[model samples]
Target: MSDDVYTGGCGCGAVRYQAEGRPVAQLHCQCTHCRMRSGTGHASYLVFAGTEAVTLTGAVRVWSLKGDSGTDKHHAFCPVCGIPLYVTFAASPGITAIHPGSMDAPERFAPGFVTYGLRGLDWDRLDAGLTVFDAGPTG
Candidate 1:
């Protein structure tokens, strides 16, 4: 991956942010929470460094939900446009999950894997080469 910063914004441009380091991982999440939040079969996410590496410029509406692991997951979205932007897991408090579609140029990052495959829609075809996991992988 390139050692360049990635910038992105909400659909209505009401919320903008700049992430200053290369992403650790990019993946398509098929968890139930993600599916509901994105209103799609899967949600594309890019894992960034931390909140310190990201600068936010607009008010974001946050919705906290419990993940399968019982951790509180905070989903942030642009109130004006109702576009999901990021998600933060209380378990992994340091990392930030950014929605690839919210980025100004999403093509810069490609999803490397598909997570929570068991909850994925039957009609959705994920990348065959990716490491499919029934749930989040243990580090």
Candidate 2:
């Protein structure tokens, strides 16, 4: 496999995905939506600049919700195991965000910063060296 290629799937192995090239960003988010979806204090994500390089297989179910920016965010998950996979944004049609835990090599997740820092829980401490933002980073 090429070093630039990343592959992963759901818990039941029913849904799978492959993403090519380096991710645009890696981050940990403490937003209420992220925490609730992950069932944790935060959720890690690998953000890709475009979905053109991404290929998905198997059946997926999507749920749409209004994001903090008032844009629609569509979250895709496996219908079998109900594992959250990737997300698409109405405002940023070219971007895609994947759950780090769903990566075949989860260790590849190297978070560079934290988002929604103000919402972060005291018990869910993050790395002290990472830059944190009260909201999503702007390009």
Candidate 3:
């Protein structure tokens, strides 16, 4: 992973993306929006501090949804396959959260913390270690 370059595409190959550099933080978000969007208990995300670190190509569609912060979040995906690739927020335009599954090496995603634990389902378990927050971590 030290090579710091990765590329991946949507299931239908209609959308592709490339990202450079390592992630600022990797975490599992248990927010309802995350669970529903991922079709699972949570979403694994690799957050990069610089939005420009990632670039996308091909036909991609974006859906805007409100985030916990009360700001619009832009979710990018492949319309053909409906595979979510990344997300950016209106509040934090400098950051980008890329779905680890949308990257070439998903195994490289080593989540260091868990957020939105208040939204976590007891039935869906995750061993995300000690750094856990009830909701979004407070400053």
- Best candidate (score: lDDT): 2
Alpha carbon lDDT of each predicted model: 0.84, 0.88, 0.84
RMSD of 2: 1.4
Candidate 1 lDDT by residue in tens digits, 19-128: 87888999988888778777889888889876697789999999898886678889999999998888888888888988888888888778888888889898888878
lDDT of 2 by residue, 34-104 (tens): 88888889988898877586789898999999876567889999999999999889898998899989999
Ranking by lDDT: 2, 1, 3
Q: Using TM-score, give the best candidate's number.
A: 2
TM-score of each: 0.92, 0.95, 0.91
User: 2 or 3, which is superior by TM-score?
Assistant: 2
Q: Which residue pairs come into collision in candidate 1?
A: none
The 10-residue segment of model 3 with minimum total lDDT is 130-139
Query: In model 1, where do residues sit more than 4 Å from their true spots?
Result: 1-3
Poorest 10 consecutive residues by lDDT, candidate 1: 130-139
lDDT (C-alpha) at residue 119 in model 1: 93
